[model samples]
Target chain A: MIQDMKPEDIIGDYKETLLDLYGSICRVVLYTDIETPYPDGKLIVSTTDKNGIITHVNKSFVEMSGYTEAELINAPHSILRHPDMPPAAFKDLWDTVNRGEKWQGFVKNLRKDGGYYWVKATVIPNIRHGEVVSYTSVRRKPSRTKVDECIKLYPTLF
Target chain B: MSYLFTVSPDFTPVHLSGWYIFNTWLQRQSGSPIHLEMYNDFPTQRLAIHNDQVDLIFANPFDAAMLVREKGFLPLVKAAGVSDEAIIAVRADSAVEDVAHLSPGITVAVTEDPDVTMMGMIMLEAGDLNAGNVETTIFDTYVLVAKNLLNDSADVGIFLAEAYDDLSSIVKKQLKILVRSQISVIHHSLMVGPKLADRRDEIQALLLSMAEDDKGKDILKSLGFDNWVKVDDEDMEFMIDLMEALAT
Candidate 1:
């Protein structure tokens, strides 16, 4: 009989194996039917081309934003942009991502309901053949402390 | 010249010696010229490694894990045995006395690097402290956080213990340690990309042999190290536990 491993043990081994492989990669999955144990957070998965145009946003993105996938598709990923965000931030983000470098920052995004949410986002370039391809992003609700920091900095940047 | 990239917690002249020593050792062993660059922050260093900007870096444990998981970088050696301790600090006269007293309305300053700040947050979350009432400020470095606290801009500050050693006596005197976290597993690890992984045996051999040379000892002393050790997964499991707990 194959013995079942505890979730903690599996997570431990998986993290170490990944560390041994990639130095700074954070694996974040966006879609799921089961509820996540972490409270007050949602995962957003978005794919964009080399120029940062939106190509796909999963069901979770549509559900969380209250926007249809049809509306989101082909739109710039920043369509749901919150007014509080500074353009300089996105400029830095694009500069980094286009270079095929992953950038992590706290972002405030607006939902269709006009309410806003904060995410700790990791944006990475999906590379193929040493050429920049799509950009994949995984975002989760950041700690409230981190969120507050972003809120405080947003007004100054704008 | 072959490029050598390294990420350190900071760019102080004291911390550059390790990379210089390692680079010299690599040059002597492989007969290749090396040019080295070092970054102070974890995120920037990680980005450099991913983009192939740096060939190797001294990474924080979590950053090392992320690189191995996401970018295919190999953890080659545990550079410098120094383990950093994180501490929660407040003004000596502040009303907040314990972990429970940290609420949302209170302002806390943290360094911009997630590795250090997140570890402190994980400990607070595990203790069930009220997070909603806290206002957090993220500065570029602990020195900045210290400046903010001294200027009365923040109610609390989280900093590494070693940072205190670098501060002026007057500034250190104004601060009081509210709590020091349980010993966290953090190390400055040397990591190499896949291109250099094939040289693992040679790399390891050079690192092991460096301590015997007079020039190598100078480099080691400058980096704040007496020796290096071969650390395995078991050595880093505590950090993994902290990351999983924080992720939840």
Candidate 2:
């Protein structure tokens, strides 16, 4: 039902505010200190409505998030936000795709069981008639060099 | 053995790679070999700078100044004819007319460098707007800042003034500069380490001559500069100011 809205309807100010509130309140389930990086050549894909509520997800995204398809659809994409990811980085991501450009960066995602995974992700605006109505994100296993760089840099950004 | 060459990813790889032609010229000039590296993340770069692995580096003015002051490095040359100014951009149709005109809830886009982004914030504060004058968003590169304004993700964007010529015509047509600043900024610089002290004058002379000839001009233009100029003490004063502000 949410995905069926017109572009203006989709940008409802209340939904943007609600997601921000929801992101602050949500908690992740705790697990051991396991860090599994998705193997090279595998992609985790997901699409969210203009408000960032998940509308479609691929098998890889489901596996990495550790949430079933049923559990993920209609959920806020923030479910995968890792504690280590800086708010500024997300600000950059939103600032990029919202401008109708593709944003590529290193991301650390929180799994359903509270484990963490890192990937190099690119998010692009899905535009129709010059209006962005949704966003599509594809994440892939990050190279060791990028991961090494992120580990040293992310601490300060947070 | 190859000489070590390093450059900061101040500009994006997609827009232009800092090391591309300069590395080739440096290698061809010296002729043993050269290993060039680009470091964008600041922390890792800090470690590398302190490790003494870098023989020569191209970096933003403030960082080059810091390295010269604290790390026993020597300032060599910079791209001539650029003020290295950063500008604040807004949608052509946006109601915001100036810094003071910015209302609450407006978003300001910027590049990720703390020093550069803070410079924009400082100027905004000087315009009588408080810290929360607008939402600031950090992009990985300066070129993308203008894209934020064109797309309506931001009402204002602060980006390198030198890069304005590189924006697509469509995006360029839709934006206007609401503010411009030559203060709190430095152009790019090439600096040499202490190990290369004996060869500094020779290297600087060669690099300067490269920007004067036709073929070398082509290389320089491709690297996003018109010519190379020797760095003088006066050229570093702004960087000193920037360092002081960053320290606080």
lDDT of each: 0.62, 0.67
| Model 2 per-residue lDDT tens digits across residues B68-171 | 76787877888777545656678888887766566667778887665556545544543444355567788876567887777778777877666665687888
Off by more than 4 A, model 1: A1-158, B9-13, B40-43, B126-132, B233-242
Predictions in order: chain A TM-score: 0.72, 0.81
**Tens digit of per-residue lDDT, candidate 2, span A1-158:** 11111223221121111123234553422333558766433447677888889988877788777778998899878777666677889989888887887788889886665567887777877654467877777665455556878889999985
Each prediction's number of clashing residue pairs: 17, 0
In model 2, which runs have C-alpha deviations exceeding 4 angstroms?
A1-158, B12-18, B130-134, B182-185, B241-248
For model 2, name the residue pairs that clash.
Answer: none
Q: What is candidate 2's TM-score for chain B alone? A: 0.83
